[model samples]
Target: MQPEQLMLFEIAPDFRDHKKYRDGIFKTKAQLKEELRQLGRDRIYHVLSFGGGTQSAHLLEQHLQGLIHYDYIIFSDTGAEPQFIHEQVTWWQHRQRACGNTTPFLITHHSSMERGLEEMLMRYIHTDYQRFQMPVYCSTLDPVTGEIKAAGMMPRQCTVDFKIIPVKQAARRAVMELNGLEYRQQMPENIGFIIDIGFSYDEIRRINTSQSPQFKYMRLAYPLAEENLSTADSIRFLEDNGFPTRRSRCYLCPFNCDGARDIGMDWDEIIEAEPLSFLKACWFDTELRRVQRSGSKIMRSIPYLHYSRRPLVEVFAAEYARISAAYRVELAEWVSSWEAAIQEKWNQDELLIRA
Candidate 1:
């Protein structure tokens, strides 16, 4: 049954993670069947927000044949993920199609100019030194004594613009395609859709129903949280089902992996596999530092992607040198034809998909 969107707000109060409470709040199978029995099967369209990452993958697997069947699996590419992630998503799409799944897997994304995080940071925002602030670790001194103190990131706007907005737009088009309606037309209130996210029990802090897009035809659902699942549980499920269990994320993101080893290992692998992308990340770090340098008074150190605040290139200088030596030809290609390469390899087709 299509649960009332407002019911989520009431039953699952802010920060309510109790299993018994959640179980009681959510409808049972029989109850769901009864509630949805009167509606046509196609009345409610389901979407899995496939971020090409671990949690979203878990959600995709979980709702494969559930009562709330997904009509579309949507991926919003920021055009900055490692080549491996793109390949994995392509493989998944083809595999699902080959298996004859009726559900369509669709990829949506920002245009090249607005795609990569680094490009956006370089182009749009500037670091304000006088207003320079750190959310976490800043060395601050007494204001009267001219002391210093310690803060957080660039902007989460990248996610909103690249991922959230694009996904919503794609989902709307997918639903329109299914119904033979114009993409820009308003969705009928009677036609419900659920945007299933991959947030898990371990990352409850990241969960917020209010942050979801508000649409009369759409609502957000967190299956992982409802089922009390964690990343480890998702990994086990994928392994048991014989699906790929790789940690899916943007290669250059410092927040990509969880632990220190995994984080270091991810960077190490990227340094070996995609040197140009690594260099670009370093360029991004350097750009931030440049902004820091502009404000001589507040500039003690440069902000960086890594926790160490060292430029990416410096951290893996040896790896960079090795790759430079091994792939001299490719390194040249990176300088002379890199933009063209991205155009050829990562250029996206029109995102709208119809059944």
Candidate 2:
């Protein structure tokens, strides 16, 4: 890589050992740990623990032990994360305190500059629901075959601007503020900050590509990918460990897919509930909204952004009894395995504790 590219971008291999980089798509626990261990022991760097714990994949309950050595973690809460996430955060707070640290897992990013997902959609896209077409059934025509697969409502945009963009800004501010590092400015050269992200190896391409002068002063470390526990394995690990794994989803996210077996709505409900939301939020031009009245649905039922780890299953059931029962036996078996792992960690890592 040339110096110019290093300043502007840094490209790395997309695949290792002839396999696509393992991101959320696939990975294992033991590999995930090794990734963290290799992340380094630098104190100047900061490891950001992403908040949205969609099935205990968030940094707190999932990767706390792997994160302590770094500096700070800036978590931007959209106030839309799943309910069980709140519980894991509470437990993580206590664990951090016991280990002589004070950072709360919940870094609620509140601001006078608050923007609701709905309101942002209207401001950016400049459209009203009454003016645009809504999908009550299936697609008018299929891409390959002219057949209607399913049907429902269209989606809106309350995620990108309200959550993704804002969080990135907050992360920038957190780096600049640095608790008190700005005033001191006393850190040594070549030992400046590193920003540790939760993205796994599968996401390495994005992490590598998502560079800017702003986020590049700090070197990056990916503990999860380094360890090899990509997204699928992380969920599998949580399920195998005994802790409740599903039903942990955001309250109003636009990216829900696969009719989450445990929590929240599928693409159908999301699109119907907030039509033309993304058309507006995507913001093609400041002067017009008519051209942007696009739909977020795939066929007639699914939201385009709603990707699923498993097959379609009703996500939000006012009554969750049936869904809860589906995973009862499986969840119990998983909990037993985690309990055993936790025990083994305590028994075997005593010397590491002192270090």
Which portions of model 2 show Cα errors greater than 4 Å? 1-15, 18-43, 54-63, 66-68, 82-88, 98-100, 104-113, 125-191, 201-213, 240-244, 247-249, 252-254, 259-355
lDDT of each: 0.60, 0.40
State the lDDT of candidate 1 residue by residue for 1-355, as single tens digits: 2468558744554425444336444323233333434443336666788887667877766555454578788998876788877877876776666666768788888545455553344332232213322221223336598744334444344555677667777888877877789987877645766677777766565544422354544556667766667778788877887877666656557554324657323776667677777766665556556655554434454366665555666777787676656666754564446444333443353211110
Candidate 1 ranges with C-alpha deviation above 4 Å: 1-42, 65-68, 111-114, 125-149, 214-216, 256-265, 295-302, 324-355
Which candidate number has the best lDDT? 1
